[model samples]
Target: RSGEAAHSGSSGELVRVQSGHGHFVHLVYDTTPAHVISELRPSVWVRADRPGIQFLVRVVFPHVANPRTGKPVTRLLAGSTYTQQGSWQQLRVDDLPKLVQAAVRPMRSQLGSHIDVREPYLDRLVLNLYAGAGTTRIAIDDLDLPSAVAVGNATEMAGRAAQKRGPAESPARRRVELAGNVLQVDGQPFFPRMVEYQGESLNFLKGLGFNVVRLSGAPSDALLEEAKRAEMWLVCPPPVLKDEPADDAQDRPMVFDARYEPVLAWHFGQGLTSRNLEAVRRWVEQVRRADEDAARPLVCDPADDLAQYCRTINFGGILMLHRYLLGTSFEMADFGTWLRTRPRLGLAGMPVWATIETQYSRELCEQISLLSSGRAPEPAASLEQLQLMVQAALAAGVRGLCFASRSPLDAQDPATRARAMMLALINIELHAIRSWIAVGNVTPEIKAANTEGVNPGITGGVLQAGHARLLLPLWTGTGAQYVPDQLAGNLITFVVPGAPEDNTVYEVTVGGLRSLDRKRSVGGMHVVDDEFGPTSLVLLTNGIAVSAMNSGLPGAGQRAAQIERDLTAYRLARVQEIDRQLARVA
Candidate 1:
């Protein structure tokens, strides 16, 4: 017999037994019955003395009490054979269910009655290790008995494994395709009318006529399932890592200890260390595995490195340019510069999305200060300011719009209520013309013909989608950080080269089509004055006149008849004023 220990066991003893032909060592542990019920297939790690050392490990259950009868039962709960020798090899009991069934079959046969062996109260676990010929020693340690819940969640474990590998593209289950500046689902042009706020259910969005929701991060499995049930598409932004290194002071790579914060903070400018790259790769894989139909866009500032990284990851070919924190003037200039210089970043073909802040100035400042070290200089844009931003982006050919607000929608204060109404109206209008907006080809910049005394901030553009042509004229408030009340009522004019064709009728309406004027064209170029308050507009087309009234406040929809009546009243008043001016001139 060799007294020298092969490996240290859990009992701090070197378990070595010698027999010319074969030998066995038995270790027993008294455990509560609940432990056995919790862990179905417990396992332990063992090491053999040398290669090709044949051994058998079994877990014996003794003094198990039958639930129906008070009799004790002895059975082999689990067992495994070790043919290969190595350091710390795991011995897992195979076919536990079959073994339990086999043990119960004989008990039933002897008693001549059906015996329920499912819930057996186990009293002890006897671990036995048997060595084959020429085997001298074995070492065992680290017994693990995991609960049934842990054992059943193999899918989550597989998802984690997939994260280690690069993200795999699943077969198109929902069939959402991005083809040349257009989004199509199931072969139909789909315009994503998306809400950016997070909510418990998508019922509110559906009520507002939105078809998609944009989330800052990946939604949970339960939320994704719920969205699928609600028939709404989701656009999930990739985790936006902080620009600085994980350890800003030491400039060391970030340690991904937190669940998702570290990974999300990985972005461009920061050198792509192995950890950062791994984190990004894992994030992509995790999102892909979570929901195949969800669109994943990288939320990043306009930068060459970020664009390159996005392209490398094969992201959903869309990059959201977030400029909401910056004031309106800066945002407009930044958007224009990025749109023009996108090709320089190797993002020529990718579409860029814009975010609209829906908070008041004070609230915006508070939120921005909290996010940064009190360095954010700009306040949040108001409802009209946000409208101007959206219109300008649209004129500059942005592909999508996201209304951003940190506050929840359930807030019923006056400001929040007004914001909700405005958002609802915007959504209604966007949903109505989403198909056209999604596929429209933008024309060159359209400037005011007579800017002699007009607001220099006025800008216009044209979008031609199929047979529908939309002329968008936007008037940004006077170049002031805080817009004056007088600036809200500026008048901007658009010059239509010629009137509509014989069969076409000129339909003019508000920004959200809240008001409408359906009238035959005069067949000549004419200048139309647009009241720049609330970002409303005049839409002229060959279709029936559909008008929407702004109500100035939120949540009000206008009927066609009401819009027609309002248009007549306003036009008549304007004509009378013009006549008075002409008479005074004479």
Candidate 2:
């Protein structure tokens, strides 16, 4: 209906939308010829014919950076507070910049996303009117939104141009392939024990038994030399974005040059929220295009906990799951069945690495929101939780393990030293059975007795390594890091398939392998009565330890021998250090 407009130059017919069932209607306006939002606010005049009628103003920005994670965000909401019934009233938001910054944090918490929020490019302004029941009409005009000097807006052309990827003219020395959830590099099964690079001595981290280190960016020649000397691999990180999504994907193929031999894989989307998932697809398409030979498999952190949505996601070959809340009963409903739904997630043949990282609980996120307004969230996780976290992920089918927390292993904090030692121990243990993890058939389900020694909290899986099978049983404890002492003495059942009565079972700890009391139960099941605590054991393995190398990879045995030699020394040193840290912390 043509009606008188609000106080403006021309009194012409205004636009209107009909409503039904108290629906939300939005009137969107393109924010072209807009300013940089330095010191401006939006105002609108709204006239309501009914008492319950409400109106709101929202503006969307294409590139509001989440300061902590350094990713862009979109959308802002504001409204009027005047209560004069049925009269024209003006609504304004004075603190637009501050609101933009503070608003993103709660969304991060609500979404359980690990994004950190900055420079905002306000894209569009919208006039929102919530209509009441039985057709309530509201008129809104003079929607003066964030007016200032014109600013340059980013276009999509340059972003798309950037995605063309770098030239790969250099001679490719080796090929990287994914063979049924195992990473095959240079024709060898590569089971990575990874950690974030924190400026620690390269030899120090290597001595701690880490096979791969995720670098901040492309590795320098000197850093490459150090990695080569340490017999370790380096993972390159993706370029950070500052604008629109598509063309933003265009720059940098992650590595400086395609010929960098030490550059093992490219790391993608760490500390990103689910909001930026679309960005991930664009990034992957660009990066995957760059790695034409597919010699460099991407190690992806698939957007923190994506339980909120069941969208199919893409990855850089390997799936590095950030199941940080494993020890705490955070009840990640997605993760509760996440590993079970792996194949359904189109991850049937992809290698998966789970992170112990920091056990980020809801309380911790709340505290970070309420108490601190700074970077660096206080560490809420403990060593005991980290120990159990390792157990749970390993017991599942994680071929690799990463300390995704920034500077976790190298920090001088007392707890951090203990964490480093604990991780070192686990790294050494994983190294001990690297082949089994790298190529063994992962059976994430092992039968456990309902009564007798086994309890409900006890769950584990089997890894069939040629002549022997490894049984890993872990105690998935409560959210508060407290557990009954009896959880340590839980019983686990393993099947000795086609084995004679003389078949022997062995228990593996971080220290070494040992013989345990094996009792046979019904159906050829050997019930092992042992203490399965949070801070002990690699797994239970049958004797003859790994049958003839089932690894068809050429020279797999020789490579394993070399890795084993280094791992044994690291394990010995770490176990000894664990004792020292234990005494020191005590």
Candidate 2 local Cα displacement, residue 288, angstroms: 3.8
Weakest lDDT window of 10 consecutive positions for candidate 1: 261-270
Q: For each candidate, give its TM-score against the true structure.
A: 0.49, 0.53
Error of 2 at 167 (Å): 26
CA RMSD, predictions in order: 27.9, 27.3
* Predicted structure 1: clash tally: 16
Over the full model, what C-alpha lDDT does candidate 1 score relative to the true structure? 0.48
List where candidate 2 sits over 4 angstroms from the true fold.
1-174, 216-222, 238-259, 271-282, 304-316, 326-337, 359-380, 447-456, 480-487, 490-502, 519-521, 535-586
Candidate 1, 413-461: lDDT as tens digits: 5345445555655665565455457777776655553436464555556
**Candidate 1 accuracy as TM-score:** 0.49
The TM-score leader among the candidates is 2
The total of clashing pairs for model 2 equals 14
Task: In angstroms, give how far residue 248 of model 1 lies from its true place.
Answer: 39
Question: Highest lDDT: which candidate?
Answer: 2
